[model samples]
Target: LLGIARFKALSSLRKKKEDWIDDDDAAQVPDSADTPEVVTMKEDKAAALRRFVDALPEEHRTVIDLAYYHGQSVTEIGEVLGIPVATVKTRMFYARKKLGEALKAAGYDRGWP
Candidate 1:
């Protein structure tokens, strides 16, 4: 069940282009449009996300890096990691849950959206 949730989350994220803005382009927003506080908030969120991922356990972190950073499918992750697809899914599920909790604790009260 959790694995299914993780898969859905990844699918949703992939479909929602607006949710994943490139930092370089984000920074190019007109000066008149962005307040300094907004810019700082973005930076802080990015930093927190990085720290969260970096702090994850190796097994969980590996699955996240492959799925999100490398754009690998669950089957592909299993192939690369020499694990079963189910195992990959489980790790991804737990990793995403931890990330959501961390973000929530960091003031992203909406959780994973």
Candidate 2:
């Protein structure tokens, strides 16, 4: 029940494009600098990341979404999910490892720009 509510809230938040990038970070990018190629590349990277994250197991994905997308700390996530703090940390560690491997496999070896 709680999980369902949390998932719904996160899903709604995720649907907002403005939530994807921080205001300060967005301000750093000049409108004039977004050449078509750069825009396409950025889109591709975002698509790839979304695909990879979506592929994660539900438990792992939940931890990642709460931590990154919602900017929640490990202790906060543990409380929200009713899991132990160590379990949350473990899930985050494995989630990050899997994401890194997926990105590398997808040819983002040098990491995101």
TM-score of each candidate structure, all chains considered together: 0.62, 0.65
Best-performing candidate as measured by lDDT: 2
- Reference-based TM-score, model 1: 0.62
Top TM-score hit: 2
Backbone clash pairs for candidate 1 read none
| Model 2 per-residue lDDT tens digits across residues 7-83 | 99999988977548889999998777678887888889888888998999999999999998899999999999999
Clashing pairs in 2: none
lDDT of model 2 at position 102 = 94
Off by over 4 Å in 2: 1-34
Q: After superposition, how far is residue 95 of candidate 1 from its true place, in Å?
A: 0.6
